[model samples]
Target: MFDSYSISELGSIFVMQGFAGLILFSVYLLMALGLAIIFGQMGVINMAHGEFMILGAYVTYFTSQAFQHFLPALFPAYFFVAMALAFVASGTLGMIVEWGLIRHLYKRPLDTLLATWGLSLILQQVYRSVFGPREVGVELPAWMMGSLKLTDTIEVQINGLFVMTLTVIITAVVAVMMFRSRWGMQVRAVVLNRMMASAVGINTERVDRLTFGIGCGIAGVAGSAFTMIGSTGPTAGQLYIVDTFLVVVFGGAQSLIGTILSALSISQTQSTLEFFLSGSIAKVITLLGVVGILMLRPQGLFTLKVRR
Candidate 1:
């Protein structure tokens, strides 16, 4: 039923599609950035990353309920508080998991993968038991529930803009921490050469825990943001895991810059394709393209100089 439209109509469709792509890019970046840090810097395969994200979403849900019940006056501001709480909740869980399990598996990356995969299953079941099998709807404040119309046919949702802004702020903050701070120097040193860094008196273990926690924390924030645009279920995080991994792997696991680039490229490509084809078909084509490119350049779009 679809056909070519007038110039004005075509322009409106393109604008709407581009904005949609931007929202998708922001979510993908958030999901990939955390995995990039843990996998690239610490060499730990956190297969449970998606579960950590779900933890954040659940935290936000509860935060909203609390605000609605006890602080009705602050209901409009629940999202900010929810975001902060989600970070802390997910980060704390990450720290505990690191101390309890991941710390011992640092020397065994493959083993960590299997362990975290099992942990992910455990977390999923726990969420199902606690929250039930149905998806819970997160209540967005009225301010975030509408759209901004650029023209009669062109409109952008406020929530999408909020997510895009959040992504930009998070990316800038992370870039600063990675490139400008002394801790960032230590993190890079550890990533480049763990034994050498340890020999130089760097507390590599501390760095590892912190890096993992930060990664999980970011995932939480992402999950919280995602509730605005997607369903929130016990298994909602699973839906994004594949795409998140695709972005991180295709972007180059060791580079945040690569992660952002990969997310944008993939999101834009998928969005454009989705406008023409069914979502399932678009995804299939996009994935096949990614696989073909990866087969040609196994190291991904970017690679660090360090030998692994």
Candidate 2:
């Protein structure tokens, strides 16, 4: 890869790729954050998580269409409304799933996995039926359509910047909610000891419902950001599900900082490698590296003290 490019050209390539990696990092972090809560904290193997993300994507697509048709003057601000609606829609579905299905299979991890997998298939068909099988792209507002001229050789995408900024804001909010709020306290208490938490007047059931809902809601926001970078399809969300799980697992699922770090490392490595190698090859190499490290430290990059 380095044999053909001059030193200056290589530097420019690296700079450009690094920025590209940051955009990928934002997506991975958002997806992994939600998975960390659902799979890590709740111990539920939700294979349908990606379906929930697609649901959000579809919601955003429809919202954009509605705004364009009925409120063209407000179309520039439609994304904010779409994202909020996405969160609400996905979160509501998650709570319903929790109450109707997941709540019954709490301790049966294998069953939850199988059940959610089936649910994913059902959701995909539903999306295909409703939205058609064609992939759909969102229309960006003029402000999000341009690029920022950082240097003669390096132009940064305006939409990428917006997505990254949104990611930072969401991550910060999640951190505060998880660590500083009363709900955070209740969530931690339930995670540590459900019976003890309930004895202390904490509603463990409610905590479980809200935790799952919030996690899915975050995934919804991720889907909204995703529309900026790629087209939405019934199966589009599946493309990132495995990668998101890897980030969560490799980072120590219970640690948000670990998730952030893992996403950064994986995203940068894969992004740079893909420039020189085939996308599949780049992914294989990244997966191999993660696996090698995990062989020695199965607990992951970071760990938290939890009661047995």
Candidate 3:
């Protein structure tokens, strides 16, 4: 296949692949960032992370429906409202779970995993009962249902660009909240030493709830963004969970910089392979490669030096 293509044609293909890789990186980072905050910062394994994303997707779907039926003039702009609602809906559920179940299991990290896993199943069933088993297609506005012509031979989907932009904005805002603000300091302190943070007058419980809520909220945003590229269903979240976990763990828990780097590396590698191979083979190769490397450095790519 390569022998027939001219150099310029190959270059264009490579560029297109790179763009696709970047979009994939953005999506992965968005999904993993929330999990990182919950597991890495709060030491809680939120198995319902994918469900939270599904909630967001559902919210976006409903928003689109409402706009199309009742507010046709605002069809294109419904996405903004949908995004906000998804964040609130998922964040509220996260806070509720934290208070109702997670709070009791704070000292028992392993139990939280089981509890959240059960919650995930419950949520999935509820979604299935309400939405049925079939996937719901999200309707995009006319303005968003097109592609941008980058060059004579290369064109990119507008939705991909939208997701990339959303990812950048969310990353910047989260970075600022995690590193530059007083709440961020408290969050870091709590992650570093929970007992010491409590001793120093930090409200550890509040921090925990907020951190988890933020994580879920980010997942919701990711789901909303994903409506452009994938299906919306109860099980849609399951598709991304494994990859999300891979990014979070491989990037190193509690390290935003590490998450971004790992997501970029994994996405680029997987996307490139996908261009030449089937999706399943590409995923298997990526997972095996990550597993092999992680076996050598169990602490991941960027281990924090805080005393445990």
Candidate 4:
């Protein structure tokens, strides 16, 4: 497949595709971080997670429109507001869902998955009714629009770089929150031994709710980031949900480092393959490879060793 390109051309292709993969990696990491916390850490199978992301995208859309219509001069600053609002909107809804439904299905993974899937459909219909069937794209600020030309054959997008930077910052913050914060310690304690943690004066229920909310909140931020790369539609989340889940699972679900590595690996592989083959074929080959590896090591690329 590479025989068609000269050595320099191949080098440029790899470089460009590698950068493209970084953007994909950023999104996958953002989406999977929440899933890792919920599914990997809390053992909750949240099928409606994508809808939560879409909610954030929609929030960003509205935030942009408001800024454009009401505060055109400050449009460049609207993104920060949009991200914060998206996080709050999605996180608040997550907390509500926990109280109304997820809390009831804690012990039943299948039930939670089915319930969330139903919720996803409901959310999609609502989005369609409100936003219409057509996909929407966010307008970029002047600073966000263009690419940096490194050479005749190599250019990098400003937005892509921003996504990478944002991903890194968020990942660092999440890692610190998961490991260093007192709330994180409580969550770890609760996950390790709910009854013991409760006896030790930790509120397991509160931790569960907060953890779920935070996970969904991260998804919201991820969705905001997605608008830079793709158009938002009611069902756009569905397109990425499977890939996000796969990255989480292929990494050790409970390991944040594992999720990052898995996302990076899967994204680069698929992106590079896409340059040489069709998108669908690239995805198929990548998935098949992942499946083959999983057949040999079901525990995934990395796993936390804990006594059950």
Candidate 5:
């Protein structure tokens, strides 16, 4: 990998690839944040999480089409509306799923996993029925189409920067909501001790529903962000679910900071490696490294110490 390129050329390649890694990091963090909430905090193996993300993608596509058809003048600002709608749509459906399916499967991780996997298939078929078998992409505004010329050799996409910005804002909001807010305290309380929380006047059921909804909502936002880089298909979400789950598990389920750090590490590693090797080889190496580390440190990179 090194013999063909001079030092200066290598420097530029590293810079460009590092930025690509950063964008990949942003996506992993965004997706893992929601997985952390659902699987890490709530202990639900939601295989259908990706479908929720695809739902948001479809919603964004329709939003873009509608804006282009009916509100062309204000099209640049349509993404904001699309994001909000994606969150609402995914979250509402999540709450309904939690109520209709997940709630009954509490304490049965295997059952939840199988059920959600089935749900993922159902959702995929539904998407195919509604959107047809073809993949669709949203039309970005003119402003998002260009790149920032940082230097002679390094340019970054405006849309990539936009996605990273959204990830940071959403991550900050999630951190505050999980740590500083009153409702956050209630959620932690319930997670730590559901019986005690219920005795103390917390509505555990409502908390569960809202937490799941918020997780799904964040996934939706991720899918909306994804439209910037890739087209959306019925099976697209499935491509990322395993990676997202690995991120959550490798981070330590109970630690939010762990989640962020792990996502960054895994994404940057796989991304940079992909530049030097085939994509499949890069992924194999990344997975092997994660699994090897996990074998040694079963509790993950960080674990919260809590009394039983």
Candidate 6:
């Protein structure tokens, strides 16, 4: 990998790859954050989580189309509207699923997994039927189409930077909501002791429903960001599902800080390696590294001590 490159070339490669990794990191972090909340707090292994993401992508696609057809003057500003709608659409579906399907399966992790998996299949078919079986790409605004030249050999994508900024804002908001707000405190209490929380006037069921909704909503935002990087398809969400799970599990599912760190490390390592190696090879190497670390410390890189 190093044989043909000079010192300057290597530096440029690192810089460019590092930037690309940051974009990937943003996407992974967004997806994992939502999964962490649902899996860690609610103890629900939602296999259909990716479908929720793709739902958001489809929402964005349609939103862009509508804007182009009827609101061309506002096309550049359509993304914000699309993201909001995506969150609502996905989150509403999450809440409904919780009320109709997931609530009955509490304490049954395997059942939740199987149920959500079936739900995923249903959602994929629905998307295929509704959106057609073709992969669709979003039309980005002019402002997000260019790159900033940092050096002769290193340039940063404007859309990548936008996604990173969006990730930062979302992460900060989640942290504040998780740690400082009254509802966040209630969520923690429910997670630590659901029976006690219910006994003490906290609506455990409501918390569970809202928490799941928020998680899926975040995934929706992730899907919105994803459109900037890749095409959207009925099956596209599946591609990131496994990797998102790896990030969540390897980061300590309950710890937001851990999720961020894990996403950054995994994305950067894979991004850098993919430049020199095949994409599959890079992923295999990354997965092996994560497995090795997990074998040594099964609790993950960071964990919060809670009563068993």
- Of the candidates shown, which would achieve the greatest lDDT relative to the real structure? 6
State the number of backbone clashes in model 1. 0
lDDT tens digits, residue span 210-289, model 6: 99999999999999999999999999999888999999999987889899999999999999999999999999999999
> What is the TM-score (0 to 1) of candidate 2?
0.98
| lDDT score for candidate 6 against the true structure | 0.94
Off by over 4 Å in 2: 305-308
lDDT of 1 at 48: 91
Clashes of each: 0, 0, 0, 0, 0, 0
- With a 3 Å backbone cut-off (N, CA, C), the pairs that clash in candidate 6 are none
Candidate 1 matches the true fold with a TM-score of 0.95
Against the reference, the lDDT scores of all candidates come to 0.89, 0.91, 0.89, 0.92, 0.91, 0.94
- Candidate 5, position 215, lDDT: 96
| TM-score of structure candidate 5 | 0.98
lDDT of 1 by residue, 1-308 (tens): 24667878878877888889999999999988888888877888888999999999899998999999999999999999999999999998999999999999988888999999899999999999998889987889999989998889989999999999999999888889988998888999998889999999999989888888888999999989988888778888888888988998899888888889999989988997798789999899999999998999788898868555
Flag clash pairs in model 2: none
Lowest summed lDDT window (length 10), candidate 6: 299-308
Model 5 spans with C-alpha error above 4 angstroms: 306-308
Measured over all alpha carbons after superposition, the RMSD of each candidate to the real structure, in angstroms, is 1.7, 1.2, 1.7, 1.0, 1.0, 1.1
For residue 167, model 5's alpha carbon misses the true position, in angstroms, by 0.3
In candidate 4, which residue pairs clash? none
118-156 per-residue lDDT for model 5 (tens digits): 999999999999899899988899999989998888888
